[model samples]
Target: MEFKICEVLRVKRLGKKFYEIYVKYEEEPEPGTFAMVWLPDFEAIPLSFAGWTNGIARFLVKVVGPTTAALYNATKVGISKPLGRRAPIPLSTPTYVAGGVGVAPFLYMKEKWGGKILYGARTKEEIPKFIKEEIDEIATEDGSIGFKGNVVDMFFTKPKTRDVYVCGPYPMIEYFRKRAKEIGNIKAYFSTERPVKCGIGICGACTINGKLLCKEPWILMS
Candidate 1:
């Protein structure tokens, strides 16, 4: 449940009010698992692993509130991420649908499990360059990058038959849920960006439907 910071690789600024911090974990946490990051004099928050290799873990953090602000401003701190439910890897080819920071976990998945990735962001500047190079396809809400319009919109144009894995805003996930029904053979995994005060599900901050988002993620079939 506890992890030491092996190294802080890079902290890059993305667009406005966003940063992607790459921290190497002492041990590699499983893909899709999140870590509870501890900041001095502040509450710990759950962050999904963006990518990991050679005892390293990366996280794409958006500075939204006090907890995240403390992390972004802190020079060095102890962090721990208790492993959580890991989505099963598809038996067939996997197509990733990611929007904004929701693309974080998929970025890690792309590294371990080679597959087609479709990433979308609000604008061209908000997109991460590293993700662009790795993904097989990309789309944007604005015409500034990749395809013009929402990432989900592109899905309607060239509907994929492969097993689908997606994470993003609720609207996007809800849309995919409906689309998946029309286009069967698609399995989807989604995560809600709820405030998880206690990573262990004690505080009950992260709950979706009747399931706990951190412990039991909803898996939809279409």
Candidate 2:
């Protein structure tokens, strides 16, 4: 289950604290599955698969804690094990709705699935140039990007696509969930940013509403 680091490529700067790190996995890893990254003198943490090419997998990591700090400092190679079930990409054409770092996983999927993306950010500076090109529409809170409003607000303005994939903060997910329910035709999947300490469902850190987030995420309806 251990994967070797084939290469470490810096894709872009996501802010002063976040950097998009693309590590080529020794073997091809599943999209939407996370890898448990081992860092020196700290706990192993789960990072979502961003994208992969050849034999590499990508991760969008934020240096927000001791373990992440150690990862940023490590110069030597590392390894990771795929831990959870792979999230399925909806077969129907999708309109991806992403905000902030939640956009990471979709960026990778967009490469393969070829779907329209609706990306939102706090300002023009926070939106990476690479992401801007990939998305079909863009919204900004500060009137610095494509549309001047929240991503949810723009959703009402556009025609309802049949499939939607949303990932971001809890509030954004909740808002989209309500909107999706109202639309009636659009199916959706949401990625929750809960802490996953033990990837095998023992820690219970990733439970939502009564179901375990890791094991029963898809069962969540409403």
Candidate 3:
């Protein structure tokens, strides 16, 4: 995989420590695809592939670690070609469930084909105001928003027929996958963070369920 050194065109702050960074790139990425991003001295990290807006590549970044903090403050960086499976996009409008920064990956899909999203956060303050238009229901553990429970609560409130795409914590993903069968016949896909060192499947560092994360579709459970 080749890392393209690019300049950051802009960094728009979406929430407290959350940023929408625009980079100079020529290609667009599909939903769930990621880029191996890195700085000169920092190790490459896989980041959610947002979208190419007006010819600029975008990424939703949250300050979580030293490298991420550095990215939040960077002007130039290295970004790899789109990685991860190009899972079939839904034909009809789909429903999405997200936790915190998990919403980042679906920005492209939400824009390509309008969809309803059930977003969850710890508090109202943690929710990014910019994503309000895309959210159908919101849940906050602190009850600072729409519902006073988890996104799963929103999922189970009604029998879902629309294909569901979920992203967030591991337990959150597993929880939904377990109960998904009970929620009727809804096709569900997920994207969870894992120890991904290589964007290609050469390294087994990101193996899960006998599948290399770098090559498989996001959170597809058989």
Candidate 4:
């Protein structure tokens, strides 16, 4: 993969500890692709492409370790041109179900293909403001928001047999795969949440159920 030195055009605090970053990059990658963001000393970490417009690329950053913490405050960084295959999105209406930073990729998808969004978080405050701006509904486990339950549970309340895109932790992905079978005609696409070390498929760092995340299409149909 090619690397480009980019300037952090802007950074905005989303909600609580999350930060939304806009990097000056010209690459207009399709939805469901990821980029490897890194600094001089910090390690490279994969981030979902949030949005792209006017020579700028966007990403949602959550401070998890040194790499991400540095990213939150970065003024300049090196990013690999968008990697991974574009997620397969059907022409039919889609419902994006996201958790935490998993909402990043769907941001662009939502713009390209309008759809209902069911965003979930542990508490009301845990849901980022950017997500709130684009999402159609919210579900917080603490009952502090639109619905009082996990996103999966909220989705089941009135299941729409439409194109379903699932992005979250392993449990959420597995739950959707196992449970959504009952929802006949639910064309679900699942994204792996594992950390991708090498942008290419050689490294097994981001393998889930023997599937390599970086090499395979971003979302796997099940």
Candidate 5:
């Protein structure tokens, strides 16, 4: 129930819709956690912890709703107590598979666990230019980027031997989940795309398979 009033340090536009918003937090939040950010005169929404560096908490936000639009315009925000838990570090090298803004959490993840990135987007323009240096492979639906297809298509181009961590749409997550189930040796976990509200778990939203995202163990294993 504790709220942290943080000052928005800066907001940098990454792509057409992707943004990196920085805020000064009193206490640093761990990677893989999330916050229910309350924008002034706008709605409170769930945001994955992108990173925390130099006393700043980073949020990779994509403006998709009126509240996010309002957040995009604000200079200050109210961040609820950090939620969720740190993702387990895989024994083998990690393979981060991200889709669109879902790439947020991996930004923090890649720091501790160095790995390759298999990023997917709709087009070249949709890809965040800032992460160009980190992306090992790319798949765009429009062939305007690295590979001319979706993430799943590129996933099989070569053998994936490392542990897989994914965050994206349900279909994409399900694709990898099914693959892991079939392969039997591929360790995989995915962040759900379910809607989250009332970060305290009072709303009963953001529940997938009876698991609450706001609580510990936010990512689900395959």
Candidate 6:
């Protein structure tokens, strides 16, 4: 629960509303761990670690609220380590399914295991050009991209049978959960988000079905 006021190394706007903020924070956070990021007078919000290089931590931030918008407007920010639990990384690399900004947490996995990305957005314009994956499968609602439906649609036709890691809206998690039941050998790890008022295990607001996302590594549903 240590906090540091880190210098902002770089900031790049992704698409229209999303941003990539690279901070000079000396924390070796495991993939899927979130940081409690904040500005001087703003509320701290949890942002997943997108990637890290040369002692700098990368965060993919979407401008959704006042706190996030305030973060977008700052050059330096506060970051804390391991706010959330580490996501489960399979012994054999897992298939990454990201809905919108959910793709943030999995960006670093590409470097580690050279995995493929199945990312979904509303349209092609929403896709970030910064992402350079070997096999990036995209799904958009309007058919402006790779597939005309959701990432689950891509999963049904061609089930890879490997472990699958998913992040995004709760409905997307449920969709994959149901699909996992139908399919025989898909191991789905859902990184769910609750109203995490406090990044640490102190606050009980982040509990989902009696399981705290801040304390649990992964929420797996058979």
Report backbone clashes per prediction. 4, 3, 0, 0, 0, 0
lDDT, residue 114, candidate 6 = 59
Better of 1 and 5 by lDDT: 5
What order do you get sorting by lDDT, best first? Answer: 4, 3, 5, 6, 1, 2
RMSD of each: 2.3, 2.6, 1.6, 1.4, 1.7, 1.8
Residue 19, model 2: lDDT of 71
Which pairs clash inside model 6? none
Return the top candidate by TM-score.
4
Rate residue 169 of model 2 by lDDT.
Answer: 78
**Candidate 1 overall Cα lDDT vs. reference?**
0.73
lDDT of 2 by residue, 25-126 (tens): 766666566677775567767777778787767777766788776666554435666656666766777777888777777877777777888988888887
Query: What TM-score does candidate 4 get on C-alpha atoms?
Result: 0.95
TM-score of each: 0.88, 0.86, 0.93, 0.95, 0.92, 0.92
Which of the two, 2 or 4, has more lDDT?
4
Q: Give the top-scoring candidate (lDDT).
A: 4
- Residues 142-194 of candidate 3 have per-residue lDDT tens digits of 89888898887777786565577888888888888777766546678777778
Instruction: List the candidate numbers ranked by TM-score, top first.
Output: 4, 3, 6, 5, 1, 2
Off-target runs (Cα >4 Å) in candidate 4 are none
Pick by TM-score: 1 or 3, better one: 3
Model 4 agreement with the true structure over 160-220: per-residue lDDT tens digits: 7567888988888887777777665667787857878887888798887778888764555
Q: Per-residue lDDT for 170 in model 1?
A: 81
lDDT of each: 0.73, 0.71, 0.81, 0.83, 0.80, 0.77
RMSD of 5: 1.7
What TM-score does structure 2 among the candidates reach?
Answer: 0.86
Error of 4 at 35 (Å): 0.6
Candidate 3: give the clashing pairs. none
